[model samples]
Target: MSRHFYSCPLRWSDMDAFGHVNNAVFISYLEEARIDFMFRLAPGDGSPSFSGGSVVARHEIDYKRPLVHRHEPVTIESWVTKINAASLTIAYEIKDEGQVYVRASTVVVPYDLAAGRPRRITEEERMYLLKYLDDDATGTNKSAEDAEDKDALAA
Candidate 1:
């Protein structure tokens, strides 16, 4: 599976007194990338696609390093880690200059606006998400084992 990458610009206000991007701000970056990916994959034209918006059920983030303000945009790579009957998990990495600053995942459920409840993923939606399934455990880029090996050697 190929990962979708989004280049997100950093704002000066994203920095905190500690001289690095605030931890909470990382959520915004992830949200932006997810939104962009969703819109691109399923436009708002009310097509048979997954046009129904989704709601985030959970978010988990691991901060690997602090991100300092820089002129270049931060790159967020995202891919579908798992897809279920009603929800899907998206894994993400925020990186710059080949260094990962954050690793995160979000659980999102398809929402029915008028019904004010969650709905099962449609067949079309499931098929669309299948194209992004990253079953290798290593993700869309490197393998998890390779990353662990590198970390172990570095330590």
Candidate 2:
């Protein structure tokens, strides 16, 4: 399967005393990338989007390597990892120069803004997500070679 990438520049303030990006910063970057991906599946032309509401029930990350401040771009690749009746698990890979720096996953629950609780996945959203659904018959997150530390980044 092909991966989808969203590029973002490293901010000067993202660095820490070690001169490398802080561990927590990677999770934030992943959030931005995931939002962009979800927004693309939203209905309407940016006005009445279908992005009603979603709560992050779980989030976890692992720092495989440190990234230094650089002018070169950082690429965040994300895709659907798994889905259940009311939750969706998304996996993200943050890399530089084709080498991985961090891999993460976020468990999100769709909420019906009016109903005020988790809701079932809509057909449109499911179809969009299914496009990138991981198909590992073993039922483990280690479904891809690049995702060896998959469960380590799960909450």
Using TM-score as the measure, which candidate wins? 1
Tell me each candidate's TM-score.
0.87, 0.83
lDDT of 1 by residue, 32-136 (tens): 999887667576655645566689999999887789998899999999988889999999999978678888999989998878899999887777777778977
Tell me, by lDDT, which candidate is best.
1
Question: What lDDT score belongs to each candidate, Candidate 1 first?
Answer: 0.84, 0.78
Please provide, for model 2 over 28-140, each residue's C-alpha lDDT reduced to its tens digit, 9 standing for 90 to 100. 89888988887787754653333888888998786777799998779998888888878888888788776778878889888889999888888778787888776751222
Q: At residue 88, what lDDT does model 1 achieve? A: 90
TM-score of predicted structure 1: 0.87
